[model samples]
Target: MAQAKTTLRTTAAAKAASKAPTNATADKLVGTLRDTMVSLVRRDGPDLSARQLAVFLTCYLQEEGHTVRGLAAELNVSKPAITRALDRLGELDLARRKVDPLDRRSVLVQRTLKGAAYLREIRSIMGETSTVAKKETETRVVRATRRAA
Candidate 1:
Protein backbone atom coordinates (compact mmCIF):
# COMPACT_ATOMS: atom_id res chain seq x y z
CA MET A 1 0.00 0.00 0.00
CA ALA A 2 2.83 2.40 0.82
CA GLN A 3 4.56 1.52 -2.46
CA ALA A 4 1.37 2.18 -4.45
CA LYS A 5 0.93 5.58 -2.77
CA THR A 6 4.51 6.54 -3.54
CA THR A 7 4.05 5.48 -7.16
CA LEU A 8 0.92 7.63 -7.52
CA ARG A 9 2.63 10.63 -5.97
CA THR A 10 5.59 10.18 -8.28
CA THR A 11 3.38 10.03 -11.34
CA ALA A 12 1.44 13.13 -10.35
CA ALA A 13 4.61 15.12 -9.65
CA ALA A 14 6.07 14.09 -12.99
CA LYS A 15 2.91 15.20 -14.75
CA ALA A 16 3.00 18.60 -13.08
CA ALA A 17 6.67 19.14 -13.94
CA SER A 18 6.03 18.11 -17.53
CA LYS A 19 3.23 20.62 -17.89
CA ALA A 20 5.60 23.52 -17.15
CA PRO A 21 7.68 22.88 -20.24
CA THR A 22 4.58 22.43 -22.34
CA ASN A 23 3.37 25.86 -21.29
CA ALA A 24 6.81 27.27 -21.97
CA THR A 25 6.71 25.73 -25.41
CA ALA A 26 3.37 27.34 -26.11
CA ASP A 27 4.69 30.74 -25.06
CA LYS A 28 7.81 30.24 -27.13
CA LEU A 29 5.69 29.41 -30.16
CA VAL A 30 3.75 32.65 -29.86
CA GLY A 31 6.93 34.65 -29.38
CA THR A 32 8.64 33.02 -32.31
CA LEU A 33 5.69 33.66 -34.56
CA ARG A 34 5.59 37.30 -33.53
CA ASP A 35 9.30 37.73 -34.09
CA THR A 36 9.20 36.09 -37.48
CA MET A 37 6.23 38.23 -38.48
CA VAL A 38 8.02 41.38 -37.37
CA SER A 39 11.12 40.44 -39.32
CA LEU A 40 9.08 39.82 -42.44
CA VAL A 41 7.40 43.18 -42.08
CA ARG A 42 10.78 44.88 -41.72
CA ARG A 43 11.80 43.31 -44.99
CA ASP A 44 9.11 45.45 -46.59
CA GLY A 45 11.67 48.31 -46.10
CA PRO A 46 9.69 50.08 -43.38
CA ASP A 47 9.15 49.16 -39.79
CA LEU A 48 5.51 48.41 -39.04
CA SER A 49 3.82 48.01 -35.71
CA ALA A 50 2.23 44.67 -34.85
CA ARG A 51 -1.21 46.19 -35.30
CA GLN A 52 -0.21 47.63 -38.66
CA LEU A 53 1.02 44.27 -39.84
CA ALA A 54 -2.19 42.60 -38.76
CA VAL A 55 -4.24 45.27 -40.50
CA PHE A 56 -2.14 45.06 -43.68
CA LEU A 57 -2.30 41.29 -43.79
CA THR A 58 -6.06 41.42 -43.32
CA CYS A 59 -6.33 43.84 -46.20
CA TYR A 60 -4.06 41.69 -48.32
CA LEU A 61 -6.28 38.70 -47.69
CA GLN A 62 -9.27 40.77 -48.64
CA GLU A 63 -7.58 41.81 -51.87
CA GLU A 64 -7.26 38.13 -52.61
CA GLY A 65 -11.09 37.95 -52.70
CA HIS A 66 -11.96 37.58 -49.03
CA THR A 67 -15.05 39.53 -48.02
CA VAL A 68 -14.85 42.29 -45.42
CA ARG A 69 -17.14 40.37 -43.09
CA GLY A 70 -15.00 37.30 -43.47
CA LEU A 71 -11.84 39.28 -42.70
CA ALA A 72 -13.46 40.87 -39.65
CA ALA A 73 -14.37 37.43 -38.36
CA GLU A 74 -10.97 35.97 -39.05
CA LEU A 75 -9.12 38.89 -37.47
CA ASN A 76 -11.58 39.09 -34.59
CA VAL A 77 -11.88 42.82 -35.27
CA SER A 78 -14.79 45.05 -36.16
CA LYS A 79 -15.95 45.96 -39.68
CA PRO A 80 -15.01 49.57 -39.03
CA ALA A 81 -11.47 48.55 -38.19
CA ILE A 82 -11.27 46.67 -41.44
CA THR A 83 -12.59 49.68 -43.32
CA ARG A 84 -9.99 51.95 -41.74
CA ALA A 85 -7.23 49.51 -42.67
CA LEU A 86 -8.54 49.30 -46.21
CA ASP A 87 -8.51 53.06 -46.47
CA ARG A 88 -4.90 53.19 -45.30
CA LEU A 89 -3.94 50.49 -47.77
CA GLY A 90 -5.58 52.46 -50.55
CA GLU A 91 -3.75 55.62 -49.54
CA LEU A 92 -0.47 53.75 -49.90
CA ASP A 93 -1.62 52.38 -53.27
CA LEU A 94 -1.03 48.87 -52.01
CA ALA A 95 -4.65 48.03 -52.73
CA ARG A 96 -7.36 49.19 -55.10
CA ARG A 97 -11.05 49.67 -54.52
CA LYS A 98 -13.66 48.20 -56.78
CA VAL A 99 -17.46 48.36 -56.62
CA ASP A 100 -18.96 44.98 -55.86
CA PRO A 101 -21.21 44.31 -58.81
CA LEU A 102 -23.68 42.25 -56.83
CA ASP A 103 -23.71 44.69 -53.94
CA ARG A 104 -23.65 48.18 -55.25
CA ARG A 105 -23.30 49.58 -51.77
CA SER A 106 -20.15 47.58 -51.05
CA VAL A 107 -16.64 47.75 -52.43
CA LEU A 108 -14.18 44.92 -53.00
CA VAL A 109 -10.53 45.54 -52.28
CA GLN A 110 -8.05 44.34 -54.86
CA ARG A 111 -4.30 43.88 -54.44
CA THR A 112 -2.23 46.05 -56.63
CA LEU A 113 1.06 44.90 -58.15
CA LYS A 114 2.92 46.60 -55.32
CA GLY A 115 0.99 44.60 -52.77
CA ALA A 116 1.60 41.38 -54.65
CA ALA A 117 5.30 42.06 -54.88
CA TYR A 118 5.54 42.86 -51.17
CA LEU A 119 3.72 39.66 -50.24
CA ARG A 120 6.04 37.62 -52.42
CA GLU A 121 9.04 39.22 -50.76
CA ILE A 122 7.68 38.56 -47.31
CA ARG A 123 7.02 34.92 -48.23
CA SER A 124 10.60 34.47 -49.34
CA ILE A 125 11.87 35.82 -46.01
CA MET A 126 9.43 33.73 -44.00
CA GLY A 127 10.54 30.53 -45.68
CA GLU A 128 13.82 30.46 -43.77
CA THR A 129 12.37 31.59 -40.43
CA SER A 130 9.58 29.02 -40.61
CA THR A 131 11.98 26.17 -41.32
CA VAL A 132 14.17 27.11 -38.36
CA ALA A 133 11.23 27.54 -35.99
CA LYS A 134 9.72 24.15 -36.93
CA LYS A 135 12.98 22.39 -36.31
CA GLU A 136 13.49 24.13 -32.96
CA THR A 137 9.94 23.34 -31.80
CA GLU A 138 10.38 19.69 -32.75
CA THR A 139 13.64 19.54 -30.83
CA ARG A 140 12.05 21.04 -27.72
CA VAL A 141 9.21 18.50 -27.81
CA VAL A 142 11.65 15.64 -28.08
CA ARG A 143 13.67 16.93 -25.13
CA ALA A 144 10.51 17.35 -23.07
CA THR A 145 9.40 13.81 -23.88
CA ARG A 146 12.78 12.45 -22.87
CA ARG A 147 12.53 14.19 -19.51
CA ALA A 148 8.99 12.95 -19.06
CA ALA A 149 10.10 9.41 -19.81
Candidate 2:
Protein backbone atom coordinates (compact mmCIF):
# COMPACT_ATOMS: atom_id res chain seq x y z
CA MET A 1 0.00 0.00 0.00
CA ALA A 2 1.23 3.47 -0.89
CA GLN A 3 1.17 6.10 1.81
CA ALA A 4 0.07 9.69 1.22
CA LYS A 5 2.82 12.30 1.31
CA THR A 6 2.57 15.07 3.87
CA THR A 7 3.97 18.48 3.01
CA LEU A 8 6.17 20.30 5.47
CA ARG A 9 5.98 24.07 5.82
CA THR A 10 8.53 26.52 7.17
CA THR A 11 7.45 28.48 10.24
CA ALA A 12 7.03 32.27 10.47
CA ALA A 13 10.09 32.41 12.74
CA ALA A 14 12.17 30.58 10.16
CA LYS A 15 11.05 32.94 7.42
CA ALA A 16 11.68 35.97 9.64
CA ALA A 17 15.15 34.73 10.45
CA SER A 18 16.10 35.00 6.80
CA LYS A 19 14.58 38.46 6.25
CA ALA A 20 14.89 40.21 9.62
CA PRO A 21 18.17 41.92 10.40
CA THR A 22 18.16 40.71 14.01
CA ASN A 23 16.34 38.11 16.04
CA ALA A 24 15.86 40.66 18.83
CA THR A 25 14.00 42.99 16.46
CA ALA A 26 11.76 40.19 15.21
CA ASP A 27 11.08 39.06 18.76
CA LYS A 28 10.25 42.62 19.75
CA LEU A 29 7.72 42.87 16.91
CA VAL A 30 6.00 39.69 18.09
CA GLY A 31 6.12 40.85 21.70
CA THR A 32 4.51 44.11 20.65
CA LEU A 33 1.62 42.23 19.05
CA ARG A 34 1.15 40.05 22.13
CA ASP A 35 1.26 42.95 24.55
CA THR A 36 -1.11 45.04 22.47
CA MET A 37 -3.58 42.20 22.22
CA VAL A 38 -3.43 41.62 25.96
CA SER A 39 -4.06 45.28 26.62
CA LEU A 40 -7.06 45.29 24.29
CA VAL A 41 -8.60 42.22 25.88
CA ARG A 42 -8.17 43.61 29.39
CA ARG A 43 -10.17 46.69 28.47
CA ASP A 44 -13.99 46.82 28.39
CA GLY A 45 -14.15 46.26 24.67
CA PRO A 46 -15.25 43.75 22.08
CA ASP A 47 -12.77 40.99 21.32
CA LEU A 48 -12.50 40.54 17.58
CA SER A 49 -10.89 37.75 15.62
CA ALA A 50 -8.10 38.37 13.12
CA ARG A 51 -10.45 38.33 10.14
CA GLN A 52 -12.94 40.66 11.80
CA LEU A 53 -10.20 43.05 12.81
CA ALA A 54 -8.86 43.12 9.27
CA VAL A 55 -12.28 43.97 7.94
CA PHE A 56 -12.71 46.66 10.58
CA LEU A 57 -9.35 48.20 9.85
CA THR A 58 -9.97 48.26 6.14
CA CYS A 59 -13.21 50.17 6.58
CA TYR A 60 -11.79 52.73 9.01
CA LEU A 61 -8.34 53.29 7.56
CA GLN A 62 -9.35 53.59 3.96
CA GLU A 63 -10.97 56.84 2.94
CA GLU A 64 -12.76 55.33 0.00
CA GLY A 65 -16.26 54.09 0.78
CA HIS A 66 -16.74 50.32 0.91
CA THR A 67 -19.42 47.85 -0.08
CA VAL A 68 -19.99 44.18 0.63
CA ARG A 69 -18.76 43.24 -2.81
CA GLY A 70 -15.91 45.73 -2.73
CA LEU A 71 -14.70 44.63 0.67
CA ALA A 72 -14.91 40.98 -0.30
CA ALA A 73 -12.80 41.64 -3.39
CA GLU A 74 -10.37 43.85 -1.54
CA LEU A 75 -9.90 41.38 1.34
CA ASN A 76 -9.97 38.33 -0.91
CA VAL A 77 -12.86 36.85 1.04
CA SER A 78 -16.36 35.76 0.16
CA LYS A 79 -19.27 38.23 0.24
CA PRO A 80 -21.03 36.09 2.85
CA ALA A 81 -17.91 36.13 5.00
CA ILE A 82 -17.74 39.89 4.81
CA THR A 83 -21.43 40.08 5.66
CA ARG A 84 -20.87 37.97 8.77
CA ALA A 85 -18.01 40.17 9.92
CA LEU A 86 -20.16 43.22 9.29
CA ASP A 87 -22.94 41.66 11.31
CA ARG A 88 -20.61 41.33 14.29
CA LEU A 89 -19.32 44.86 13.77
CA GLY A 90 -22.87 46.25 13.61
CA GLU A 91 -23.77 44.49 16.83
CA LEU A 92 -20.76 46.17 18.41
CA ASP A 93 -21.78 49.53 16.86
CA LEU A 94 -18.41 49.68 15.16
CA ALA A 95 -19.90 49.77 11.67
CA ARG A 96 -23.19 50.00 9.81
CA ARG A 97 -24.58 48.77 6.55
CA LYS A 98 -26.69 51.02 4.40
CA VAL A 99 -28.54 50.74 1.15
CA ASP A 100 -26.60 52.61 -1.53
CA PRO A 101 -28.79 55.38 -2.99
CA LEU A 102 -27.24 55.07 -6.38
CA ASP A 103 -27.43 51.31 -6.32
CA ARG A 104 -30.15 50.00 -4.07
CA ARG A 105 -29.00 46.45 -4.63
CA SER A 106 -25.66 47.21 -2.98
CA VAL A 107 -25.00 47.74 0.69
CA LEU A 108 -22.41 50.29 1.77
CA VAL A 109 -20.23 49.81 4.83
CA GLN A 110 -19.93 52.90 6.99
CA ARG A 111 -17.77 53.90 9.91
CA THR A 112 -19.28 54.72 13.28
CA LEU A 113 -18.24 56.99 16.15
CA LYS A 114 -17.62 53.94 18.29
CA GLY A 115 -15.41 52.51 15.58
CA ALA A 116 -13.33 55.67 15.51
CA ALA A 117 -12.95 55.56 19.24
CA TYR A 118 -11.88 51.93 19.10
CA LEU A 119 -9.26 52.72 16.49
CA ARG A 120 -7.88 55.44 18.71
CA GLU A 121 -7.70 53.03 21.60
CA ILE A 122 -5.88 50.51 19.46
CA ARG A 123 -3.36 53.15 18.41
CA SER A 124 -2.71 54.08 22.02
CA ILE A 125 -2.14 50.47 23.03
CA MET A 126 0.29 49.87 20.18
CA GLY A 127 2.17 53.03 21.09
CA GLU A 128 2.52 51.83 24.67
CA THR A 129 3.73 48.46 23.44
CA SER A 130 6.42 50.15 21.35
CA THR A 131 7.52 52.26 24.27
CA VAL A 132 7.77 49.24 26.55
CA ALA A 133 9.77 47.31 23.97
CA LYS A 134 12.14 50.23 23.56
CA LYS A 135 12.67 50.49 27.30
CA GLU A 136 13.38 46.74 27.49
CA THR A 137 15.94 46.96 24.68
CA GLU A 138 17.61 49.91 26.37
CA THR A 139 17.77 48.09 29.66
CA ARG A 140 19.37 45.09 27.99
CA VAL A 141 21.97 47.32 26.39
CA VAL A 142 22.71 48.98 29.73
CA ARG A 143 23.07 45.59 31.44
CA ALA A 144 25.44 44.34 28.77
CA THR A 145 27.57 47.48 29.09
CA ARG A 146 27.73 47.18 32.89
CA ARG A 147 28.70 43.52 32.66
CA ALA A 148 31.55 44.38 30.27
CA ALA A 149 33.03 46.84 32.76
Best by lDDT: 2
- What lDDT score is found at residue 62 in candidate 1? 48
Give lDDT tens digits, candidate 2, residues 24-96.
Answer: 6779889999999899888888999888999999999999999999999999999999999999999999999
**What tens digits encode model 1's per-residue C-alpha lDDT throughout 1-149?**
99999999999999999999899878766766776777865654644455556766776654367656766788888988877777767776766778889988777767788877776766776676667777888998899999999
Model 1 CA lDDT for position 149: 100
Q: Which segments of model 1 are wrong by more than 4 Å?
A: 13-28, 37-46, 58-64, 131-149
Model 1 RMSD, rounded to 1 decimal? 4.9
Model 2 accuracy (lDDT, Cα): 0.92
Q: What is the number of residue pairs that collide in model 2? A: 0
Q: List the lowest-lDDT window of 10 residues for candidate 1.
A: 43-52
Please list the C-alpha lDDT of all candidates, in the order they appear.
Answer: 0.73, 0.92
- Per-residue error for 16 in candidate 1, Å, reads 4.5
